[model samples]
Target: MNPASPLDNVRIVLSHTSHPGNIGATARAMKTMGLSRLYLVNPKSFPDSEADARASNARDILESACVCTSLEEAMGDTFLAAALTARSRDLSHPTRNARQAAGELIRYAHHHPVALLFGRESAGLTSAEISHCQLTVQIPANSAYSSLNLAAAVQIMAYELRMVLEEGVVADEPDPQLPEPASLQEIEGLHHHLEQVMVQSGFLDPTQPKRLMRRMRRLFARTRLEKEEVNILRGLLTAVNPHKPT
Candidate 1:
């Protein structure tokens, strides 16, 4: 049997959303990021034509969305819940940047369900609603004018969640078919060979080497030269000065 996707364990909750179109757009955003679980807490409008029109290809997400009467009901069975808010309150949970908070949420979602809660469009989450979350995430934006539309906020959070999950998976599952990178020994050989050619060619001064080799090493490191690339570079260096030991 196919293992369940980590995304299945994530729920995007919108509380007291005013516009049905924003819900539809949010669904589209979530669907683009491979998130399908959606919960609406006392939305002003659902099953509205504007929502259906905006959902477009992501109508499935909206069609299956769970509508609840309250935020508590929407957060049911979630092991971790993060509230997205721009406001600062005395009693609110300590806030984290979106990416940092998403990483924590991704880790929790590995073992249990997690929820990302967003508040109303006009006035974000109430203090009472914010208290229900274990963490509060604030998207870093220009503080002078940092108000984001309901759908835009949802898109940013959904994108962050998808990125964290995808990044973790990529780290854990390297492609077996891809060639291994050039080893330190091979890279060193290439560097030494290039230095010999450069010295012979008079482009580099071996007598007074000042950060030249170090800069070259940094350049190669940035390239992440593959084994084949190193071999090609060695051949090119040999061509430059065949008399020098390659």
Candidate 2:
């Protein structure tokens, strides 16, 4: 059997999309760029006639889309996720232009599943939602009217990725012998374990987190943690709190 295409490991994730037509248009856009994986997180509507109609000749993309209840769920198996947002957030992840991010994303996708995350049409990704991502990608547009339609944003990103792939543009490749990158789910587990230890140790007050964990997340997100590294950190946390359950 042929090896899976790197694009196959790159999924387009739409979260809390309020409009069905945008979802269909997004599928159509992805299809045009040779992207097939689509993940919908808590969409307002799906399997709707409007969406089907908007999908045009790309109904198969919509039909195969994965529906998720949460952004975390949508990104569970992904090793890297880039949040597409025009708005600035406090302590946001490292920012990259669309073209720059596409190169990096494609490089990572060659090793593991990666995601390009888009938020709702009316409002972009929530701060908490963006926190789940490792990088933030912005499509350069007129500052006076930076807002882009949901499908349009997806199309822009998909086009950039397609161009990167076609042009053979990729970021500095990591050593192939390095350990695999940790999945989002695994990283989340490490976060949870660290938070539990922090709360128990009085380092982080649950009542007033005051962005403590958020900062930690930002720090770790920059690390591009590996699977073994995550396990080692979790082990350290456990060692620090031996009484706590594993």
Candidate 3:
């Protein structure tokens, strides 16, 4: 029997997708790559005939897709989120080529939830949306006309992930003594706790907040903090502000 695929823990998140056909085609693309988890965030049209028709034999993926009201909801438990975009932004997160990002995600998904986040068809993810992602992945395309169909982009990413699994390019199993990496929710909680302490301690001013917190978020995003590490950090934050609980 074949070994289980790490793709099982990697979810495809379509954010505010405008076209139902693309949504269906994305599901088909993911299914072809042996990826079944699909999360839709505020899709314009779903459960529509066009999507069902496009999905074809992969209709099961569409039927089981998790629909959420927001990206945060879709990424609730995901430990890593890689945003797909071609545009450059003023404030960007750590970036990697599609292949590199896919390999990293495959390794992480071996034992935890990770996500590939794609934006709408007309325009890619907003800077605010991109900020939430820990990494950005850009596909190399013709510079003159770099635009790709939403489904095509999904296919490319899914293909890379499938290749990683088929080629057995994954991180070795952990030693089991170390705590598991913290989940996205846990990390977000840590951020919240830290921010509260920072504000209370006068380290960060809420009124004219510079990119301080954003930079901190980026710094922590790349840390891949373990559960124990997060606990230790939270403990430090509590120590800093003993009068007020974080």
Candidate 4:
């Protein structure tokens, strides 16, 4: 283990992880790959027996894992944060497979502390959460069933890094995105209005909306709407409303 190698310096961040076992397993996976840094950002549950038990031989990692109150705090000093999202997101960040993500990690690790952030098992990374990351890793999978466990996502990325680092093929170029990144508050407001419009248009039924929202999320994600585009859509939406604000 190069005490100072990229893999050693890279931190595996679990954001709002719900399961203790996943936390333990994530530590074990990180350990198995010769990684030691683990960060927990507002875990739903930690310091539990199951998690400690699952960590088993890797308890040191659990003990050493930094507990952070927020993702921004956990990402402190990290110039490169790559989040694992099951599908595309509205924010346009460079999307890569596990290999490419690992390569980027290693490339940036020398100058800065890099983080690989994974979200909750059910929701994965939220749009607001994804905004913090500089890039995203999309594991190629069947479109029909693409869900993967949070820990599993971490393991795959870790394994890829271990392999590529051993072969010494780590390098990266710049990641491109919209010139002006939209703010989180802006997106939240837009989504709220969007939901109302969908409901008013009878496109999204409140009763069984999970799937519909999921699909809509994917649609907006694919669009990677820019700030100007978001404004245009919101403006058009407002213009059509019969009762405009005075």
Candidate 5:
């Protein structure tokens, strides 16, 4: 069965792409997988002849690639956005390998439009850019020489997502039926609440609190806590500091 939406509908966003050839190659990759939506966020150059030459017949992808002023604009309405990065992020947003990320892309696409984010070629996505995503995607590489080029990275990931579309799942992923995650606003509030509790209880010394919060934030992000877990934590904080005030 064909995908419910056209390839033109799948937006492949590139932030600060420096190579024209890589942009062309990325278009080819999406075309081969029947995914066509390409969004360019402040790309180095567009309508480059080199890019068109590399795209060949897939020039349509280049021709139609949406140019956005910012990454925020490109991914604003997208329900699920995954930023591909090679290194670990400092804030430690949820991370998934290529295969697992492909599954999530499929699942999220079931309800809302999804966006796959790619960063510049020299260095992959920056920490700030990754923070913009709900989760991060990393491809497992050999212990040595782990760097992947922009086009190659997108090609590998796009191939994985296409495989999921072509071949149905062999074993279904577990379904916990958890409610949606708390909004970013609520999560930020939870962090503030937790911070207040830590300070009021003398659990964290103000002078050394940065390291403590950084590690704790990393620990908390991995849980991918559902709305309920966050609520539980909020309630726990209230119990701990009845008079601390939010």
Candidate 6:
């Protein structure tokens, strides 16, 4: 792996993971694929003996893993995040197979930080959790018995990403003249600002808020907003409602 490989900018995020052993196994899996960044969101257990034992030689990855209270915090700095899900969703982001998504993620990972999200061992990622991500990825499997272990899923995705890197296949370099992509934190802030303006302007009724914001999120998710674009939109929102803070 190159010292400054794009994999360095890609993080593997496991949310609400229940098994410490799986966490350890995931660390081992990530290390094998040259992916070192690991973020744990509301995991059931960590820094435990079981996890340490499972990690084996990859204990260093476990030691350096980041633990966060929420998925938002775990991916705040990431420019793009893709959720791994087996089930279909009503208003989901664009769906892709593991290999295709790996290629797309690697493209963005070259210019900015990106993340891959995995959910709980049993239920997988919630709709709300999936909504937080900009893209959804599914691993093709036998329809009859497609269930996969948490660590197994991570390993599959990691391997695909590694393949993309090793093959020297990546998107063209980003134009330096354009502004950087918007980080998750900035996008969330824009969402909040937009909502505030909508509420104050009586455009979004707070009493019966339904899928309006969810649709808005989906719309923006498709756009892959840049930092400057986000700022411009927020500025417009502020203009619409001067009393509201940007």
lDDT of each: 0.79, 0.89, 0.86, 0.76, 0.76, 0.90
Q: Could you tell me the TM-score of candidate 1?
A: 0.67
Model 3, range 19-63, lDDT digits (tens) per residue? Answer: 999999998999988899999999998888899998989999999
Per-candidate TM equals 0.67, 0.94, 0.91, 0.69, 0.72, 0.94
Model 4, span 1-246: residue lDDT tens: 667677776899898989999999998888999899999999988888889998879999999999999876787556567889888865356789888888877876655577888988888878767766667889888899988877777888889989877886654332444244333344445666777777777777888875565545445544544567779889987876555576
> What are the per-residue Cα lDDT tens digits for candidate 1 across 1-246?
025666788899999999999999999999998889999999998989999998889999998999999865777567667889986665446678888988877765655678899998999988667655666889999989999988898888888888886676434343566554554456667878887887888888988754576566545645555779889888888777947555
Poorest 10 consecutive residues by lDDT, candidate 2: 168-177
**What lDDT is obtained when candidate 4 is compared to the true structure?**
0.76
Task: Score residue 240 of candidate 1 by CA lDDT.
Answer: 73
**Model 3 global lDDT (CA atoms, 0 to 1):** 0.86
lDDT of 2 at 222: 92
What is the Å distance of residue 210 in model 1 from its true position? 67
Q: Clash totals for all models, in order?
A: 0, 0, 0, 0, 1, 0
How far is each candidate from the true structure, as Cα RMSD in Å? 19.5, 2.2, 2.2, 7.3, 4.8, 1.9
By lDDT, the best candidate is 6
Query: What is the number of residue pairs that collide in model 1?
Result: 0
Minimum summed lDDT over a 10-residue window in model 6 is located at 170-179
Judge candidate 1 against the unseen true structure and give its global Cα lDDT, from 0 to 1. Answer: 0.79
Model 5 TM-score?
0.72
